[model samples]
Target: MSDLLRLATAGDVDDGKSTLVGRLLYDTKSVLADQLDAVTADSALSTPDLALLVDGLRSEREQGITIDVAYRYFATPRRSFVLADTPGHVQYTRNTVTGASTAQLAILLVDARKGIRGQTRRHAAVLALLGVRHLVLAVNKIDLVGYDESTFTVMAKQFAAHAAGLGYPRDAVTAIPISALRGDNVVDRGGRTSWYTGPTLLEHLESVHTAPDPDQTPLRFPVQYVIRPRSAGCPDYRGYAGQVAAGVVRCGDEVAVLPSGLRTTVAGIDTPDGRLVEAPAGQSVTLLLEHDLDVSRGDMITAADAPPALTDEFDATLCWLGDRPLRRGTRLLVKHGTRTIPAIAQELLVRLDEQALSLCGQPGELVLNDIGLVRLRTAEHVPIDDYDTSRATGSFIVIDPADGSTLAAGLVGADLPIQ
Candidate 1:
């Protein structure tokens, strides 16, 4: 396994995303002594509110709200971390979506005094929708609540009830009562709490198993580049260059290239040095086919034994993130796997009211951060598995054509009906 795990920190404004991140880094000794002194000095100059060092934005620094994503890197002996500090404001929900798109785990901060607010509910619902497996509800600012165990228990239970209703596993979340300002229950267990003796926030991150399942479905290789030999020694060579997306491709495995249903046998797996015995997901290499085949970009190579659903029109759950509300006839760019194609939003469906966690009436235009189902017809047939089945290949982003900004993100083939 690679030594890095991607994690995103999210919450409403002033929920301690920056301070929690700062505390995690500081307690793990990831920050330097000189930097600590500088932060200390900065804290002294401020109005005793310079706790959020991860708020790198000057505007956020002045306004005391996280406006952009701040990334911090730290590690323990067992695991390494790349924490994406996403914005808490409702306007920046698109940024949060981008940050959490690749995250295996999310560290969602909540104010201990306030418990779960509307923003907290919204962020949690978003993370759950995005398929984030693990959730660490850092009940920050515990010092403000007198480090009360009853307060922590009540908050955890309240949030747990809602999260369980969302179909998240009972044990998927681990709540840690912490005070990012006082450095309690973050790295070292807070001294004031004898009632709580669980792992610290840093400890949980260092020990969680947050990797995707090994490609157990079908072998998929999206052909990115075609390599043709130019020498007399190797005259007849047709190779497809790209990383494997899922399953495993062996030297003699029968494979079918998508969008054409052309069958071919893998002759060899080629690397810069030489041939590889096999290739799996994340291995960037070239495939030499036993027979000459016409392959190019936007073409997917799948296992002959098992194939993905080849369809032109499909339903998907989308989170609209564009400033200009989505209207009918809005042609956009759809990126699936390594394929980019022209697509048009066919329907508005319904706008999800996140504050109430339910669907409202029909919406003509999908505003910012509205999660709903959308119908998109592509220019060509694309092979996509269910998002619940294959997240790597079933998810796509919709980009606006006029201004060239990403408008929404979607997950295909979900069984749960759009609410």
Candidate 2:
């Protein structure tokens, strides 16, 4: 099987994100015949309206704008893709956060006529905050601008500088000029503007390096269940079952159970497929430990050599998604990995000015779709890692305890700008 690449689309409305996604699926032959036929039947133009393939909602089709995140899966000979076509409306920026949370790369679309809008900058900042290292600036509608090389060049330079300010490395960002409606530089390199030499969007998608390898990072496995089978054949089987969040775990390796600080050894690795010698990140397996400590759900199993610190209070950067404002002293639930703990919004540090790409001191409260830094106090000690070290172990969601609605997506450590 080919390696998978998780990516998302972002930018202002009418930038043709849905069209671009639909174009990709269409050109790659990933769309089904019935789906294409339905779109073709609904289309009023000479050719089939590709955007209809992704804009599935009735409201979206009527308004010709994306309001929700639409996910599409496709595969090429070299790689597989999970593409998230995120919303462009400011109110739906929270949905962009959701779509890009697990994305390894983001394609920030921009209309050639209107270079980069404020929402584009905001989405870029959010992508940076989420640790999406790779980016592709798809400058759409080049045909409307007469395929001017200067237009694409100027916009690419501006975005490159902005991405640098956001801490993206030089090679992490790529610029491609294309007309999503015309299918230029999308799947294949059409003979339009021979001035451009960059790879097509599909080629780039197939070859670019993806997110960091979880198996190479520190071990972080939060036990979801303590498997104790009472069957007649195996009466003494006690294994901790959960997905490996990061790093690799091998049988006989020394491990540490968090919150209790108990040391143990991995006696064996169990899987439904049969016993295994080792398991890497992203694998769901049962770990049989040498010592049966009081490990349970919410307890973390980590490599003994480098275990996370137990903490009740920690600073985090929040992408507030709540409909209501997030004020200090508000009680919330912090769901990290397999554990959920009661926490309070102890302090609001600063809010990000996405357009200005700067911090706005300390805000009284974080409003809807606000990205801010805050301090949180948990009711119990939880093992947490910095997002830079482990994306799985360092990220969490803030839930409204009253209604259980998710309020914000949080990164364990703040990625703040230098004042």
Give the winner by TM-score: 2
TM-score, prediction 2: 0.94
Question: RMSD (Cα, Å) of candidate 1?
Answer: 3.1
Candidate 1 weakest lDDT stretch, 10 residues: 44-53
Error of 1 at 296 (Å): 1.3
Off by over 4 Å in 1: 1-5, 32-65, 207-214, 229-235, 415-419
Q: Give the CA lDDT, 0 to 100, for residue 377 in model 2.
A: 99
Candidate 2 lDDT over residue span 224-273, tens digit each: 99999889999988999999999999999999999999999999999999
How badly does each model clash, as a count of residue pairs? 0, 0
Q: Can you write out model 1's per-residue Cα lDDT over 232-341, one digit (the tens) per residue? A: 98888788899888788899999998889999899899999988889877899999888787789889999987889898788788888888877766788888888988
Worst 10 residues of 2 by lDDT: 209-218
The TM-score values for the models, in the order shown, are 0.89, 0.94
Model 2, residue 33: C-alpha shift (Å): 2.0
Candidate 2 residue spans exceeding 4 A from truth: 211-216, 417-419
lDDT (0 to 1) per candidate: 0.81, 0.92
